[model samples]
Target chain A: MKFEIMRDRLLDGLNDVTKAISSKTTIPILTGIKIDVTDNGVLLTGSDADITIQTFIPAEENGDQIINIIETGSIVLQARMFNEIVRKLPTNDVEIEVENEFQTHIRSGKTEFHLIGSDASEYPLLPKIDDENKFEIPADLLKAVIRETVFAVATSESRPVLTGVNWIIENDELICVATDSHRLARRKVKLENLPTDVDSIVIPGKSLNELNKILDETSNPVQIIMSNQQILFKTDHVLFFSRLLEGNYPDTSRLIPTEFKTNITLDGKTLLQAIDRASLVAREDRNNVVRFETLEDNAVKISSNSPEIGKVEEQIPVHSIDGDELVISFSAKYMMEALKAIDGQGQEVIVQFTGAMRPFILRQVNDDSILQLILPVRTY
Target chain B: MKFEIMRDRLLDGLNDVTKAISSKTTIPILTGIKIDVTDNGVLLTGSDADITIQTFIPAEENGDQIINIIETGSIVLQARMFNEIVRKLPTNDVEIEVENEFQTHIRSGKTEFHLIGSDASEYPLLPKIDDENKFEIPADLLKAVIRETVFAVATSESRPVLTGVNWIIENDELICVATDSHRLARRKVKLENLPTDVDSIVIPGKSLNELNKILDETSNPVQIIMSNQQILFKTDHVLFFSRLLEGNYPDTSRLIPTEFKTNITLDGKTLLQAIDRASLVAREDRNNVVRFETLEDNAVKISSNSPEIGKVEEQIPVHSIDGDELVISFSAKYMMEALKAIDGQGQEVIVQFTGAMRPFILRQVNDDSILQLILPVRTY
Candidate 1:
């Protein structure tokens, strides 16, 4: 196999696929990236057994010749070394050729590299999914949904299912939820094209994080297909596949409180900054807890006390306070993260407190699409 | 004590002094920053026993009132926490007051913090240095000298003296040298006014690193005073004191060879890029060895080989190659760093090779102010 391609075009394809390659994979061949040069384009594939990524570079892009193919074949080279070499190549044009016994030669400018390549036949086959059960969504919207909910997924593996974000689609509405039990993030979006058979699936938070990074903010459509065990997100030039968690996700619909004893509307940024200061002292405690109390004149007092360190209190004015006077304590980190996520949408945030011992919900003042719930700590 | 000072001005002082404060210090008081409110200004000091930094913020600067001092006293607060609180305060002006029981109150806008302060009298006293043994150098030049040599200092503490940079002053010339025995970096500058009694001193690499970060790139004069056990660096508003290492530095004067068999001149940036690419494959080897061989017509071949992985070779053009043809191998990392340091000054670099086993020297083509030496590895 021999081909000369534009260096930047090849580099872009390599960067996209290399994200799925892992050096820690037990399957040795999984650490290698597979390259196939066909008549139309060049395809690159990388996998780590759980996730696979494939990117393709067409021979011609916008009437510009991107690749000149002398022959067509396949080979798998070390992903990391190959990527680094391509990144540092001096010239814009690179030539790659595969000799007898899979000896791959890469040249650019006056620099040349000879890497021992493995036979492409040894690579594991990627799981196949039918395109019949697929739905399309804008790339930016999907990215936003992932960002709003992915951070709440449990990091620990004690309960394996909780390490993923649960996705449910029904009645043309798609809901994404992530919870570590202490806090939960939920985002719902209305969709026109829905897959009827796909009811629910739990995708590892790690997968969504990688996908979010790869997905551009453009409004281009991304087609998603779901199989029995594998899910694939297909963009214009790249295909991303991730394996689904085996266990059933816990039902979190009932965990959110609908009734509230007190409600307050305040600027998300102001409260975020105040809690950040209070957290300076509370961070020394095991729970990182801070107290919040409603006051007269549409204001709230936020404070944290540590006998060994000191105490901090800040009075933040709110837009309005109604229902009842209340005091509650919760993890400052949880509150801060929730406030940050809400602050991304709008400045005004409405916080509803059920009681001192129950969970509280924080959402945009007029938008119910995104909700952040935090369980209070009994600091008394 | 009570004072209201501009938040940014106080933050600048805190940032400078906090470089010396370490929470891991065995002496608890060393972890706290001592603040003294005097009629003239506010003094902030932080010390980790080995090094101390003090910065003063005057009451007025450029005819603007920077601080309003209501009273005068002193107290010690936790360095890390206080710095964070000040960084996040909302208002431009911050009020600090200490009560009779050492209860420190910090207020800005609607936020307030009460920290448990300690008596400043318990802080260790800084050693006094005589002004008779002092010299002044431009801050930018000093920072450049440190950057060029500090990276070559030995990181291992087995030979404590080698972990420091040796500064020698003689006949109005200041010479700085650092080496880990395998590689060495030396820089020299001529000065008009020099101290007569001060001969040589070894300053810890760690101390120089911190001082380099604190020093800004300006032509302002920095006064350096050498004492028996401590060295003081005095700037306009900051005083930095560091303890000297107690040991004799080895004489590296004889290690640098004046005679050479092969000389090659090349662009520093081009060689650096080529070496960076070659190191991609050589990095896996124990010594990170890359081979350099002179070619006909003022060209050289740079190559690295790892039997298990691959091989890389690049031909780099040079302006001229004089003397006998030579083949030598050295650590790619050392060569790259030396080239980078030289690239900071000029693009033209002259490389002198004595033999295959002898150390080689690299320096600017027309300047002798800085020199780098690297010992070759025996591959055969």
Candidate 2:
């Protein structure tokens, strides 16, 4: 590939694709980034075996020229080293030229580098899916959904399907659910033009994390297309493709409580802080367990103790409590994370539980878009 | 002990002494912090086998009462957990009361902690260093000296003395030298009340690093007292004790060349950046070797090439060139680090070398307080 491109524009394109590059991949070519220069612009692709990212820089952006294509060609350069070289180049523009042996020369100002490049043809072809099932969503909203639910996904591979966030759609309602048995997080967003053929699909939590980071750097409309086993998230100049899990996700609807014997509302920030203190001495390997109990005075007691270290007790005032006084215990770490995920400007959340041994549900008092559930630990 | 102290004031004391608590220490008591509530104020102490740090909170500071003394007693609490608990307490003041069997109750607002404390007698006493050879230096100046030379100390324990910085005082001048054999860094400062009996000593680089961090957070005079095998640094409310290395530091005077065949000057920042780019393709395990050669046109070519990676070349402008034409190779990593230590305010530095195989010297033109030296690597 031979081209002269603005350093900043090329660097940006390289960075986006770099997120998908696996340095420890078993495939040699996957460790390199394929660069293709054409009359249209310059294209960069990076991929591991499971996911791929491609970014394009047009010949011109807005009214300014971003690339001057002298020759249309392709080559692959070591992703890690090439990115570092590009960042440290001393000029505003970089000229890259690949010679006969695929020895690519990159020059910027008085500095020049000749890199050993691999044949771009060795790179695996990006999977192409029929565009019959696709829908557009604000990139910001998708990022929010991923953040709210992805954290609850199973991190272990014991049940491979649970490692992904389950996406379900019906009647133009986009729902995402993630559960690791002990806790579950679900978020729903209304869709305007939901594709009729699209059904439930499981996308790996890791892939969602990478896509969320990309969306964080941009605010644009993202078109998502789903096929039999692969899904793609495409933005203006970037395309992110991820593989889907094949097995059916477990039924989590029954895991969430339908009725409650006790309901309590408390400020999210106050409860989060109280649990944080109570967990200070709790053993991390023990899940940092903390106990909660309702007092007749309408205040809730949060406490935790480590036999070898110390014990902490906190009396946090609550907005209200109904039904019988309740006592339950759960992982303080999980509770704190749940509270933080629903946390906002003095906002309060209602906790509904059937019994000490049953799973409890937490949700913002007035918002139905997000719900979190945690299975209580038996500690009488 | 029974007392109520401002949370922030107590926290500051805890943080200062907590630096010396070794989390992995074999000595069990070293993992705990000793807290003594005295008639004057509260004192906190933490120690590992090698170093100890103590901090005091006065009853009043700047005419404001910092603590309300109810009784006097002493106890030792687990350092790591107590600090975390103190940081998350819910009130402005924390009330601590020790009852029978060393059961300590800490309360703030409606939150309380019952910590298992050991008898304070189990804690090791801070070594008492004689004050006969004591001298005072501004905390900022000591911190600066540490920063300038500590990086040159040998990181490996193979050469025990090289792992510390050699400190010397004579003729009303204090000079500190450190070297890992391949390179040497020396810094000197004029002493006003030079101790007549003090000659030379070596302080562990790790201890100096910790002291530098403490100094960075405060501005006050630090009195350093050197004894037979220990050193003590004392400030208004803090006392730091560090053991001295027994062996004599190697003489590094001969490592610095007094005359050279090639004397060149360049902009520190420019040479630093050029070397950085050249080292990008160099093998990391081999110190990222880069070559430098003088051109007849008063410019120097900085280049590096790796068979498996690539080649990089840069032409850096020079301020002046003296003596003979030269081509030499050295560790780009060492050169960059040395340059960064001297980098500031677009300064210029002089490079002096005897030949392609001799050790070279770098200094800030006419500034004699600091000097850096590096040995060359022979490359055919």
Candidate 3:
């Protein structure tokens, strides 16, 4: 393969695909990135057996020549070295040429590198999936959904299905739920073009994290297609494919409380700071729990203590409070995560609780697109 | 101890002294920072046995009030946690109040923390040294001298004295030298005040590194005092002490060749880039070595290769070349460090060598303030 492309444009495309490349992969070939050149431009592919990322550089961008193609071929080169070389090249454009075998030469300015390449046929092919259920969503909205729920997924491998986020679609409403049994996060949004019937799929949290990183901040639309076992996300000139986790996801609908005896509204920033201070002392223990006690209708007591690390207590002002006085303890990290996911101009959030042991829910006053739930710790 | 101090000013002072604190120290008290409140102001000290840093926070700076002391006492607190808490406190001012025992209460904003403070008497005392040999140098210039030579010190601890920088005072010139046997760096400066007789001392590389980090980018002069076994650096409000290495530093005066058969001058940035590109391939090997070959009178070739990785070659333009054509190889990391220490805008550096197996010297035209030497590696 012989072709020349702009250094910056090629670096961008290479970076997007490199997110899937694992340096410590058991399969040696999986550590290399496959490059293919054609009349269309160049395509770079990297995969780690679980997810595959492919990015294409077009021949022209904004009516300017980005790639001047002389020949068309394919080869696989070491991902880590290739990326570093491209980034440090001292020129605006890079020329790559592959010879009879798999020896590829890259030239830019006065610098030239001859890299040992592998046969492109050695790379595992991406899983083939029929476009059965396909829908479109704004890239930013999808990124927000992933960010809100993905962090709550179980990180342990004991329960593989629990390590994935559950996506459910019904009547054009898109619901994403993630839980680790200790805590849960759920977000719902109305879809522009929802799938016909009721559908549910579990995508790994790690895959969503990689996808979120590649999604830009633009308002571009992303088309998603799913088969029985795999899902494909296409945006601009890039394609991301992730394998679905097998088995049924737990029924989290029953875990979220439907009623509440007490509700408290407080500024999210103030509560976050109080919890952060408390966590400095609480995180030393096994449970890492922080207690929230309501003294008056407009004030809440936040306190945490550890046998070895001393104790912390603070009074946080609240906008409004009602019903029975409550003192509940839960994971400080979980509460912090839930608070960070709430993004709005107003700093107040309404927290609803059914009982001391029951899972509580947190939501913004006027915005209901996001929801956070935390299971209280039993500290008798 | 009871006092209210401006949070930002106190944090800044603590940061300077905290550089000597080590989290992995075997001595428990070394991990704690000693705070002594006097009528004048507050003094904070942190030490890791090998190096001690003490900084005084005055009652006021410029026109801003810093410390308001109500009681005079001393206490020791965990260095790491105290620094972090002070940095993230949610107030402009912080109040620290201690009871009869060692229970300390720190209040900022609405948050309060009860910490278990230790007795300041338990902490190790910093060494006190008085030396007749003293000199002053610009803070920036002293920082530069340390940066240039410290990197060449032996990091492996195989050679005890080689792990320190040799400071020699002769006539009115202060010279610093460091060598790990493979590479050497030397820096010289003219001083107004010097002892009548010549003197030499070896300070630990790690100590110099921490001292450099603590030095601000001001034009204030730093006083250097040297004794038989210890060296002290005193600033206006900070005092730093470093123990001298016991063994005699090797005499390297004969290692640098005064006459050379080959010489070349090249732009530092251009050579840096060429060496960087060559490093990409060389780093795959055990030594990470790159080779340089002079061509004719105005060009040089840089190259590196690994059997499993690939090969990289680049041409670096030179300002001038004389004597004979030569080829040499050395660690790319060493060359990069040497290039970074030479400060100037588009300056040409003269590199001289006597033979392929001997140490080569690098310097700027008519400037003896800085000199770098690298030992060649045998390629065969």
Candidate 4:
């Protein structure tokens, strides 16, 4: 294989695929990035058994030639070293050639490097998915949905299914939910071109996090294909594949409280800042719990006390307070993360309480599509 | 202690002193910052036993009232927590008051925190250094001196003194040297106001590193006073004290070879980049050794080889090569750091080589104040 390509264009492709490569993988060959050169374009693939990422660089982009092909072949090189070399190359143009016995030569400006390459045939083939079951979502919307719910997934692997976000599609509505038993986040979106064959899938939070980072905020459409064991997210030039978690996700529909004993609407930014200060002392405690109490004249107090670290209290005036006066305690970290995910800053959020021991839900004042629920700590 | 000070002003004082605070210290009290409120201003001090930093925020600066002192007293608060609280306070003006039983009240806007403060009398006292044995150096120059030599200090505690930079002052000349047996960096400056009594001292590299971060790149004079056991660096608003390493510094003067068999002058940046690329492969080897050999027509080749990782070679042209042809190998990391310290980019640097096994020295073509020496590795 021999080709001369623009250093920057090749570097972009390497960066995208390398996100899925792990040097610590037990499968030694998985640590190598497979490169295939053809008359059409160049493809780079990286995988770590659980996730695979492949990016393509076309021979020509727009009116400029991105790659000049001299021959067509394949080889796998050490992903880490190759990426670093390309990044530090001096000139914009780089020439790569695979000589006899898989000896790869990379040359740019006055610098040259020779790396031992493995036969690309040894790389695991990408899982094949019959394109019959696929759906399209705007990249930006998918990123937002992932951000809103992924953090709530359980980090512990005791229940592997809970470590993933559950995606359910029915009646032209796409609902994503993530929970760690202690707290839950749910986001609902209406889909126009919903595929009937695609019903429910569980994607690991780690995969969604990586996919979100790779997706741009552009409204470009991303086609998602689902197989029984693997899911693939395909963009214009990149394909990300993640293995689906096995097992059934818990039914969380009934866990959300529909009735409330007290309700309060307040500026989310103000409440978030106050809770942040309270957490300064609350974080010293095992539960990181902070107390919330309604005061007179549409005001509420946030306080936390650690016997050894002292106490903190802050008062914030709310827009309105209705129903019964209440006091509740919950983890400040959970509240903060939920508020941020909702983009609560500069917006009004309504909190509904269903007694001190029950779970409460928070959502934007007028938006019904997103909900954040947290189980209150048994502290007064 | 009661005072209403601008949050930003107080934060600046906290930041400067907190550089000396380390929670890992065995002395628990050292993790707290001592704040003393007097009629003149507020003083903040933090110590980690080996080093102490104190910053003063005056009541008035240039006719502007920065602090409103309501009462005069002192208290010690957890450095990390207090710094975080002050940083996140909402209002510009913050009120701090000491109530009964060492309960410190910090109030800003609608937020209030009562922290458990400790007795200030229990904090360690700052070392006393007499002003009679003192000299002055520009803050920016001192910072530069530290940067040039500090990285060469031995990190291992086998010879504790080698972990510090040795300073020698005589005949208005200030010379600082640091080495780890394999490589050495030396910088010299001519001082205008030299103190005869202060002949030599060794300041811990860690202390100098912290001091460098706190010192601004300004021409403001820094008064450096040397004592039997401690050295004090006093600025207008901050006082930094560092305990000196007690030991004799080995004489490195004879280690630098004046006679050379080969001499070459080249653009420092070009050579540095070539060496950097070579190090990419060299780093995989235990010694991180890169080979340099003179080539035809004033060109030199930089290369490194790791049997398991392949090889890298680059050729850099020189401005002049007047001496005999030579080949040598050295640590690429040491060479790159030395070049950066000398501000080698966009400047001509002269390299003098005595032989393949002897140490080589690099310096600016016309400047003799800074010299970097690297011992050659036996790799032929």
The window of 10 residues in a row where model 2 chain B has the poorest summed lDDT is B212-221
Q: Using TM-score as the measure, which candidate wins?
A: 4
lDDT of 3 by residue, A42-101 (tens): 999999989999999988888989999999999999999999999999998899999979
Regions more than 4 Å wrong, model 2: A217-219, B217-219
Q: Which stretches of candidate 3 lie over 4 Å from their true place?
A: A344-346, B61-64
The 10-residue segment with the lowest total lDDT in model 4 chain A:
A191-200
In candidate 4, what are the lDDT values of residues A52-122, reduced to their tens digit? Answer: 99999999988888899999999999999999999999899999999997999999998999999999999
lDDT of 1 by residue, B1-380 (tens): 99999999999999999999988999999989999999999999999999999999999989999999999999999999999999999899899999967999999999999999999999999887888888899999999899999999999988999999999997979999999999999999998788888788999999999999999999999999997688999999899999998899999999999999999998888889888999999998887999999999889999999998889999999999989989999999999988876653347899999989999999999898999999999999
lDDT of 4 at B131: 86
Record all residue pairs in model 4 with backbone atoms less than 3 Å apart, i.e. clashing: none
Which parts of model 4 are misplaced by more than 4 Å?
none
Q: Clash number for every model?
A: 0, 0, 0, 0
Which candidate ranks first by lDDT, i.e. highest?
4
Candidates 3 and 4 compared by DockQ, better number: 4
B1-380 per-residue lDDT for model 2 (tens digits): 99999999889999899988888999998889999999999999998878889998998888998899999999999888888888999888899999997999999999999998998987887777777998888898898788889999999999898999999987888999989998888899997886778689999999999888777545577898998689899988889999989887877786778989999988998999999898888864366899999997779999998887879898999989999999999999889888877663378899998999999989898797888899999888
The collision pairs in model 2 are: none
- Deviation (Å) of B379 in candidate 3: 1.3
lDDT of 2 at B222: 89
TM-score for chain B considered on its own, for each of the candidates:
0.97, 0.97, 0.95, 0.98
